[model samples]
Target: MIKQIPVLDCCTLSGYKEDELLVDHLADYLHKHSSLAFPHRHNFYHMVLFTSGGGAHAIDFTRFEVRPMHMYFMVPGQVHTWEFEGEVNGYVINFSREFFQSLLLRPDFLNGFSFLNGIAQDGAFQVPAHMEEEMTAFFERIYEQVNRVKPLQKDLVSVMLLYVFMRMEQQLSPAEKHKFPVYNYTLLRNFQKLIEQHFTNLRLPKDYADLLYITPNHLNALCKEYLGMQAGEVIRNRILLEAKRLLVSQDMTISEISDELSFNDNSYFTKFFKKLVGMTPEEFRKNKA
Candidate 1:
């Protein structure tokens, strides 16, 4: 019997290979069926630079059209799918949250960065021929140092990677910077972090409220004020989004999905799903498939 590969998080990517930094060029050969391969969110973050071809990429409910010279970032817990046509070339850099935290102390740096904002306002940055040569040189340097046996050299290469990210941030448009609000951003950020961690096991508004050290009402208000949706709505949307992803991509039965989401019972799960989705789980899956 063929064994199945276990699902891995971003942190676990380092352990899979002997050269930790080689995880930087990590690219997966995804076939058509590859979309069904891994449905869970990753713990580590990703910076994907697409060099060629076109496809549909989805994160949460947001989707993007993939083409050459397109760069995208996927933070932990954002469920994503990439469907590619023909050959694609690019580098996928995987680094932990700690890697970024150590470099960007200011919360506004990444919080303000959004692919949507960039595409909407500044237009997707097309790497000029000269710039591509420079980027290739930087990547080659990192690759060589990562493969080096010396520990000091490896650390230096890591620093270079940090420099690359900082440069990329600088290239972002001013509109993108203004999009992210510094104050109260931490609350939203922490709430998202918590949701990614416990969405499967804990779905209640009070659970998140308690974790954030605020009342359920306050949490709801904050989510509403900033996101234009209540806390409960965010929680339910995430759960339902995951449900749809699994239903379309996995062979798991409805009962299995219910158990995975920690629903009280299969019937309750069905009704809850129907109420929000306007159809039974089976019907939804059938329509999608």
Candidate 2:
């Protein structure tokens, strides 16, 4: 049996209050809605700042320790669950992709952010102590604007959100800033978009290369140069992530998961998973349990 995970819509989850965006105090939001304790997927983007807390947050297949002065980012389709000790206080912001694209006039605008672009090794990080107050203030302003009945509401939210991202960009060191050149960034974005579309059926580098109008070698070289990994690793990692999600979050049998992922057979999927994860699917599922 596959345990069904809830796919939450931003507007509905936020009480259908402010259209496609929701900004609120984390503790207050949790207080009102207790069901968030369960693992869930959001159809929109999610970012939360932790002013105080100690716990664990699992994003995809990795569990990250929670700490103060930290931020976690989650793009659509990623599975996440969290447990915090004592009083966890901070701000939570959620917005849909359509909402962002409408305001920015660019469908792939989020590719520029390391957090959303899969360029960040882990989706959570600790903010420098000196920047905590400033980050909090930005979230506060966004919360206020979100709740206010004002003209040009969407534009106002977009400006405030862009300010936050801009401030984050400014904090990046010169080396980090130059990590991805403009052309490479475009390739990365296209590659990621293609993966989301075809990861289920197409797992080969040549297949993706054909889609991107590049030769397989060129695609592999670009991925290695920018992401520090071959294109195949990127594809395998994504499939592995989804496999883990199904194994742990859902109650699917190993054979069922293998079939669902379109593997040649159960044995091939098991071998492939163990090679990368250092454990068979059954072992991984047992460990999670």
Candidate 3:
């Protein structure tokens, strides 16, 4: 039997049966939810604006250092865990996919923000020194808004969060923004989403390109331009990430993990893991331990 890592949802964190959003101070949330400081996944969008802290956290196997005025975002299904040095305090918001539907006209308003688009590297950033005052106030407002009892409170909170996103988006350089046009970002993000779903069954770039209705060359070009890797490499990276994720389960042996990831055989899987990772699966697991 496999002992799966925990997947936390809004209800589990807020203790509200029908809650779709959670807004709280980081210190308070951490105090009540310290048990979740292990490897886990969140079922909703999660973001944190750190005002003060030291240490590190991992999102989708990538470790990021925790520091003052830094923020990070996580989309649903990404695995993350927190490790703080001491007395971390900031703001955290977790909202469902539908949290903005009733308040916004565009169904895809949230997708326009690069920081919230589900990539681990793109989502974490340090708040600029000039914007720190305004940025921190936005989070404080969100913390206060959630405590108020009023009509359309969720809608109001949604708008405030949108403002926060807008200001943060301004901090990104024009070169970064111009590199990924809307059409290209849509295709690239969709391709990644498909890989998340079909990586085990479909390992080729052409397979994903066909589904996205673009030529294989075009797919690879977009990936190279934006992600600095070929489309196939992106797919393989997702597969490798899942392999690492599965290895987190001690009950699952290397053979079982290989089978779970739909590799043809244990030996091939071992070779694949070692080639890209520079270590055997067992070695990677033991090292992480």
Candidate 4:
């Protein structure tokens, strides 16, 4: 049997079975819950602000060096693990998708944040030193408001979270903001979401296009125009990303990974991997090891 990676939920982290929203200081949270350092995928979104600390955080397949004034954003289903050298101080916000979609009444809310999508760029950002106080206040308020749990606490949480997102968006490079498509981008967003959910079973661009109610030609055209790649390439890249993740994060052999990823055979899987990565899966694993 194949080994299964751990998938954590908000309840698991906070140990508060009823609450979907949890906020706590980084150091205290880590000390209180020792199991969080292990590699796991969460079912809820996470926002971490590091006021003081130095470490590296692995999200999905990529490793990001964490430092002061840096905030890391994670969406549900991305595998994450962290290592901190010394005393770490910060704040963590964990919220469910329902918190935003149902409570906040924003269905496509997460799509608005480029960093959260994990396609345009990595999910970590360095905040300017000058804006330290302003950003800290946002988290502080969130911590206080979360603990209060008044009648309108959810509403308060929703508004404050939106403010935090807006503040971070202002810090993004103008080019980064304008480079990707803005208007009418839902089609692409929906296509990407579908790819994430059904990549193992659905490998064809037309497969996703059909699900999105658009022609494969139009999908390819939009991908080429906005993302500078064919729709098929986007699908392949998503698959490739997951392949790399499983290869590196787990002890599974190439054959096992091929089977898990639903490839026809190990030979075809190796060829497909080497074509895009320029290295066979075995070679890549050996190099990483």
Best by TM-score: 3
Please provide, for model 3 over 62-180, each residue's C-alpha lDDT reduced to its tens digit, 9 standing for 90 to 100.
Answer: 98999999899998878887778988999999988888888888987887787776678988888889999988887888887786554437778888988888887877733366766
Relative to the true structure, how large is the alpha-carbon lDDT of every model? 0.64, 0.80, 0.84, 0.80
Q: Residue 46 in candidate 3 has what lDDT?
A: 95
List, residue by residue over 1-289, the lDDT tens digit for candidate 4: 7664667878877644555878898888888888654667788988899988887887875777778878888887787778887788899999887787655565877767767886524478788788899999889888877775564457768889988888787777332555655543778878888998999999999898899888999999988987789999999998998887677655588899999899999999999999999999988877755
Sort order, TM-score high to low: 3, 2, 4, 1
Give the winner by lDDT: 3
| Model 4: worst 10 consecutive residues (lDDT sum) | 173-182
| TM-score of every candidate | 0.65, 0.86, 0.89, 0.80
Model 1 residue 141 CA deviation (Å) reads 4.3
Q: Which ranges in model 2 have alpha carbons more than 4 Å from their true place?
A: 1-3, 16-19, 118-122, 148-152, 172-178, 249-251
Q: Give candidate 4's root-mean-square deviation (CA, Å).
A: 3.5
What value does the lDDT take at residue 257 in candidate 4? 94
* TM-score quality measure for candidate 2: 0.86
**Residue by residue across 67-181, what tens digits does model 2's lDDT show?**
8778888888787888788888899888887777766777777767667764334457777777988898888888887776555478878888988876776665222656666
Local accuracy of candidate 1 as per-residue lDDT tens digits, 189-218? 678768867888888999999999989998
